[model samples]
Target: MRILFSSLVHTGHFFPLLPLAAALRDNGHELLFATGSDNHDTITSLGMTPIEAGIGLDVGAPTAAEQLGVDPDPKAERSPEELVRLIVTAFADVLPRRFVADLEPVLAERAPDLVVWEAGNLGAMIAAKRAGIPSIAHGFGRVGDDDFDVQGAEVIQRTAAEFGVELPGGRGFGDRYLDIYPESLQGKRFLAEEADLRIPLRPVPFSKPGPLPAVAEGERTRPLVYLTMGTAFGSAEVLRTAVAGLSELDVDVLVSAGPSVDAGELTGLGDRVTVESWVPQDQLLPRVDLVVHHGGAGTTLGSLGAGVPQLFLPQGADQFIHAGVVTEAGGGEQLLGEAFGADAVAETARRLLDEPGYRQVAGRIAGEIAEMPSPAEVATRVVKPG
Candidate 1:
C-alpha cells in the first residue's frame, strides 16, 4: 500500500510519526510525508519522499499569540493553559487555511491509499475527507486536554464554514486513533474513549542519526545527568538555571539546548557542564542517572521507556500536563512558574537521584510500555496488502 503521512513539520510533531512510518516502510509499504518545504532535506535524510504542505508559525508575521495578545517569549509569561489555547487555535483555526491550499494539489496528484496525520492538523483531515481517503489520527503525547475540545470545536466551526466542508463532529481526532501515551501517565481527557478504533502503540524513543559518545564502561566515577529544553522551547534562562542546579550536584552534566538557542550562550557555565546542539537520546537515556528537561512528550516517554528518573521544568503547552501527571505517578517531580529556579531544579533533581521510589515507579512504567503494542505490530494491523 502507498501511505501518506502528515505532521506540522516541526521536530516534536514530526519525530513521533517517524517510528510508525519506518515500521510501515520496513513492511514494504511505499511512504510519503507531507510537511513544510523547510523539512524536505530532513525528510530525504530519513529515506522518505517529502510532499510540502503545512507551514509552522512565522515569527515575522502576526501569529495566534499576537492575535490573542499573548507574548510568546518561549512562554515565559503565560501559563500552559493559556499557551494551549493559543496552540489549538492556531493549528485548528488559523494555519489550516494555508494547509488546505498547499495540500489540496498534493492530495489530488498523489492519491495515496491512506493518510496518517498528527493530532494538530485539521487541514490534513479535511483534505483526506475531500479526496475520499481513509485517515487515522496519531497523538504525540497524553490522551487529551480540556482546551482541546473547546478550542477545536469553536475554531473548527468557523473553519468548516469557510471551507464549505462538513465536519461531522467539529473535532480533529479521526475515526481511528493511534494511542502512544501510556495509560499510567495518561490524563483525564481520555482520547481512547473518543475513537471507534483505538490502537495502543508503544512510544519508542527516536533521535536523528548521530554517533553515541563513549561513556566510561563499568563502574561510573559520577552519575551522568542529561538536560534538554526540547527543539521549540530552548530558553537560555531556563537552560542556565538547570545547568546551574545540575552543576551544583556531584553528577556530571550534559546539555543540548536545541537549535533555537546558541550553544555559545550556554557555554562557560561550569567545567563539569558540557553543551551541544544535539545528542542521541535513544542511546543516552539508558546511561543517564537522571533527566532535567522541559516536559515535552517525546522526552518524558523516552525517559520512561529507559526507566530514568526525571525533573520536569515545563515551559508551556502540553508540558505542564506531562509534568503534573508524572509527578502524581511518583515517577518524577516538576517545577512550574514561580517555583522554577536553579534552587528548585536542584532540589527536584536531587530527589529524583537520591530517592528509590522514583526509579521504582519508572521501572514499572517501562515494563508496561514494553508490553504495549510495538510499531511493527500496529503497522500490520493498519494495513495488509490484498
Candidate 2:
C-alpha cells in the first residue's frame, strides 16, 4: 500500500515521524514524506520519497514577539496574548492555502492509499478527505489530554470548511474562536453531509529498547545533565546561563543549542560543558541523569521515553501546558516566570541532581514509555485497518 506522511518544518515534529516512515518502508509499503521545503534533505536522508509541502506556521512560539521583531533574547519582556495572536494569524487561513496548493499536486500524481497527518497539518487532512482517502491523525505530545483533541477537531472543521469539506457538528470552547480566523478559509461545502470525516487520533509512535547510542568510553562520570531550549528558542543567553549554572556544580553538561542558535556564540563556559547544534535525544536521553529543556513536546516525550527527570523552563505556548502535564505526571518540575539567571538555573540543576524523588519519578515514566509500540508497528496497524 502507498501512504503519505505529512508534517511541518520543525525538526522536532518531523523527526519523531521519520522513524515511523522508515518502519513503513521496511515493512514493504511505499511512503511519501511530505513537509516544508526546508525539511526536504532530512526527509530524503531517512530513505523516504520527499514531497515539498507548504511552509509551516510558528506553533512553538511567543508568536507575536517573533513576528514583530522581538529578538529571541528579550532583555526583559512577557506577553502571552500577543504571542497567541501571532500564532493564530500565521496559521489559521494561511495554513489551508499553502497546505492545499503544495499537496494537491502530490495527491494528483501519487494517489496514496491513506493519509497520515501531524496534528499541525490542518490542510493535509482536508485534502485527504477531498481525495476520498482515509486519513489518520498522529498525536505527538500529551495525546492523553482531552483539551488538545477538542482544539484539534475545531481546527480541522474550520480549515476543512474553507476547502468545501463539511465537519461533524458539536464543537465547544476555543472551537468557537474559529470565526476569528482569516477569511481565506471561507468557501463552498465540497464534502457530503453524511460522510464520516472524523479521523481517529493515534498515540505517538515512540521507538523503544533498540538502536540506542553507546556511551563514550572516556565519558566523565559525574552526574550528566542535558540542556536544550528547543529549536527556535534556544537563545544565546539561555545557553550561557545553563553553562554557567551547571559549571558551578560537579556535573557533566551536554547542551544542544538547536539550529537557530549557534553554540559557538556562547562564551566563558567551563571545561565540563560541551555544546552542539543537534544531538539525537532518543539516543542521548537514556545516558543522561537529568534534562534541562524548554519543554518542547519532542524533548519532553523523548526524555520521558528515556525515563530521565526534567527541569522545564517553558518560555511560551504549549510549553507552559506541557510543563504542567510533566509536573502532574511526577516526572519533572516546571520553572516559570521571568527568571533566566545563573543562580536560578544552578538551583534547579541542584534540585534535579540531588533529589531522589525526581530520579524515581523519571524511572517510572521511562518504564511506561518502554511499553509503547514501535512506530513501525503503529503504521502497520493504521495501514492495514480491519
lDDT of the candidates, in the order given: 0.80, 0.65
- In model 2, what is the error at residue 25, expressed in angstroms? 0.7
The TM-score of candidate 2 is 0.80
TM-score, candidate 1, is 0.92
lDDT of 1 by residue, 1-386 (tens): 88999888777788889899989999888899998887778778777899878778654124777778777564355665876677666877767777778888888888899988887777887778777788887889885557666777777767866777776652334447787888767754464355456678999888777875544235678998999999888889889988888777898888887888998888688767778888878878998999889999999999999998989988766788888888999999988788888887787888789989999999999999999999999999877421
Please list the residue runs of candidate 2 whose C-alpha ends up more than 4 Å from where it truly belongs after superposition.
Answer: 58-79, 143-156, 169-219
Residue ranges of candidate 1 with Cα displaced over 4 Å: 59-61, 65-85, 170-174, 188-192, 214-219, 384-386
Residues 1-386, candidate 2: write the lDDT tens digits. 99998887776567666766777889888889888778787667667888888675553233434655664443345465544444554444466567877898899899998887775666777777777777765545543234444444565567678778786543211111111111111111211221243222222423223432233224756888888888867778877876787788988788778887976786557677777667766667768888898888778777776678888888765777667767766778766776767888888889878888887887776665555565655655667552
Give TM per candidate. 0.92, 0.80
Local distance difference test, candidate 2: 0.65
